[model samples]
Structures are given as C-alpha cells and as structure tokens.
Target: QTDQPVTFLLKDRAPATLSIAFGASILWLLIGLSSGIVSALRRATWIDKFSQGTALAGASLQIYFVGLVLQFILVDKLGWLSSPGYVSPNDYPMEWAQGMILPWITLGFLLSAIYARLTRAGMIEVMSEDYIRTARAKGLSTRRVNFKHVLRAAITPIITVFGLDLGALLGGAVITEYVFNIPGLGKLATEAVSNVDLPVIVGTVMVAAVFIVIANIVVDLVYMVLDPKVRLA
Candidate 1:
C-alpha cells in the first residue's frame, strides 16, 4: 500500500474543479441556447451569418490558445481580472467570480458554439413541422410559437449534447485547467500521468465515470419533463 490513499488526495481538489466546470457549463449552455434561438429566428440575415462565422471560428480554436488569449487580454493587458488561479468561493465569493470568468469563458466557448449551431438547426427543423404551421395559422403570437412550441420540441438533442458535455467537463477540462494553472481534476490527472501514479489515475477515471452516469440520469429525467410523449415504462 502507498503512503496516501487516492481518495484522500482527491478529496481536497475535486470540489473546486467540479465547481468551476459546472459553473462554466451552465454559462456555456445558456449562451449557446440564446444564440441558437436568435440565429434561427433571424435566418438568412446578417446576424445569422455573423453567428455562424463566429461559431465556426470558436469550434476551430483549441482551448489552450483561447485560454492564453483571454489571459493576455483580460488579465495582463486590461487588468480586469486576476491571472489564472483558483479562488475558494466560500471564502471569497466576489474574487472567485472574477477569477473564474475568463476560465469559464475559455472552457465554454467552443461548446457554446457547438450548442448554438445545433440549436439553430434543430429550431429551423422544428419550425417547419406541421404543428408549428397550425399554431401560426391559429393567430398565436410569434414569440409564443417560437419559445413555447418551437423550443420545446427542438430541445431534445440539445439536452443530450449538454448532458455528455457536462459529464466530460466534470471529468476534467484538461487544456483549460492546465493553461489556467488551476489544480482541478484534469490537471491532477495530468500530474498523475506524468508521475506514473496508477492509483490516482484510476481514482480519477472512476470518479469521472460516476459523474457521467449521474449526468445521463439527469438528462433522462429532463427529457421526460420536456417531452410528455416520453414515458418511463
């Protein structure tokens, strides 16, 4: 046996990493959903074109590159936020938010882009369904039709993608964690690999698996709520 158990080593580090990832994922999903809805509504316009172009660019960039650029602009040049490092939210709530803003943005940007594109495609397809046409013919307001009818139908795939993304992030945002020098699970896993620490590596993987299982369960529950057609039986 080793001097320290894997769980003991991970106990102190996992919370901060998971917290950052969870917060970042929420921000990412919101931005993506809104962007996708707007782009779908404004189809074929300049706004749609701009959003598509931005999403393409974001998807192409790597997390490390994005993190570095953000640090240079936001932390080094403008002095808006502190340089990369984790701040305990319990002790310093404001500082934690300030410190996390850039990391969260960097980690989430690519995912947001993917979500936006998916959302737009789903919305466009949903809008063409017969029910949507019937709703429009019934003199329902555009806003209500789009939000209540279109989004509800279009959200299934988005929820699936979000669940997978959240689970993976909980495992680790490797490049983002490394670039920001945050002692999150990803970074810990990286260190463990470098050191050839088998126990730590195994522990991390097990924890990640648990996170994925939980996320999937949550997604299934959300799917039931979103689409009444889905039955537990």
Candidate 2:
C-alpha cells in the first residue's frame, strides 16, 4: 500500500520472512529428529508413546488456533512474552529472538509433528538393518551408533522433506506472519491481494518459487555429498 515499488517492498520484507523460516527450520528439525530418534530407539516405551501422542496433537491442531492459544497463555495470561511483532535482529538481537519465539513455536510445531512420524518410521527401518545390528555388535557406543551411523542413514528423507518445507516457508508463512503481526512476504502478499496489487502478489509468488527451486538444488547437493551412490543412481 505504501508508495514504494514492489521490488522495494519485497526487499524490505524479505529479511523477516527468511529469518522466521530459518528459525522454524531449526526448531522443527531439532524437535522432530530428536523425538523420532529417541522414540525409535525406545520403541514401545513411554517416551515413544508420549512422543506419538504429542505428534498427533500437533498435527491435528490448526495453525491459527495454536497461535491464539499461545498468545493467550504465554502473552496475555502469563504476561511473560511481549505481544508478537516483527523486530529486526540487526536492531536488537535479543528482542528479535524473543519476538520470534511465538511464531517459531507456532510454525515449527506442526511441521515437526509430521517430521517426527517420518523420522520415526525411517529410524525404525534403519535400526533393523543388518548394518545397524553389526554396528551394535561391534561394541560401538550408543551415542556413536545412534548419531554417527543410524541418524545419518535415517535422516536422508527428513532432509529432503525439510528442503521443500523450508522452501515453502521462505516463500511466506501467511497465517503465521498474520497472527504474529509480522510484515513478512506472506503479509505483503496478503495485503497485496486485499489491495489488488497484482505486481506484489506475482512478485511474492515468483520469489517463493525461486526459494523452493534453490532448496531442492541444495538437497540434491547434500545427497551427493552424503552418498556418492546418489550421484551415480
């Protein structure tokens, strides 16, 4: 709506969207991978059951609902966090992180639920392989066996999915930015649509597509580095 050109608008808003996506990516990967790995190693245990339960809940909940509930409990009720708003990290690193925590949690959680299930299935399958058994039989420490061997194998698909998810997030997290009152690309697109700013809307879509394509390329490179066989295959 501002008099600035679409390019300027995109450039201004790009950082916020990217930072949000990057933050969420870290949270989802960590939560999802850790939970999945642990659940797999401790199959049929209470930990596994709890993880599964949480994953189910996370997946089922809508993003808007999650954001509102978090705001109510964490911001409105507890009076712990400030209300969600975008603040540049360059201006105030600490405040930036604090501001982002809610959006990160909101965006991070739902995807983590899916990743948790995917990783769990992958881990279970990898753990049953002869190589896994052999690694354990070799008297390798649990940490080494799990991280060095098991995780490396089980994490491949997670990486692929993460690439696509990250790409989409980078494009714009509409509901999240809206709920959090952050003026990221998603919000820009939203406003553009409301204002019927065709240029901005098209610009955001193109930018998002670029991110997705780049993410896929990065994933393929990761695969090649992780497994030379992938390059050949």
User: What TM-score, over all chains together, does every model reach?
Assistant: 0.95, 0.94
lDDT of 1 by residue, 131-207 (tens): 99999999999999999999999999999999998898888778877888888888888889998889999999998
Instruction: State each model's CA lDDT, in order.
Output: 0.87, 0.91
Question: Which residue pairs collide in model 2, if any?
Answer: none
What lDDT is obtained when candidate 1 is compared to the true structure? 0.87
Clashing pairs in 1: none
231: Cα error in model 2, Å: 4.2
Error of 2 at 177 (Å): 0.9
lDDT of 2 at 97: 87
Tens-digit per-residue lDDT, 95-115, candidate 2: 888898899888889889989
Decoy 1 TM-score against native: 0.95
- Best candidate, TM-score-wise? 1
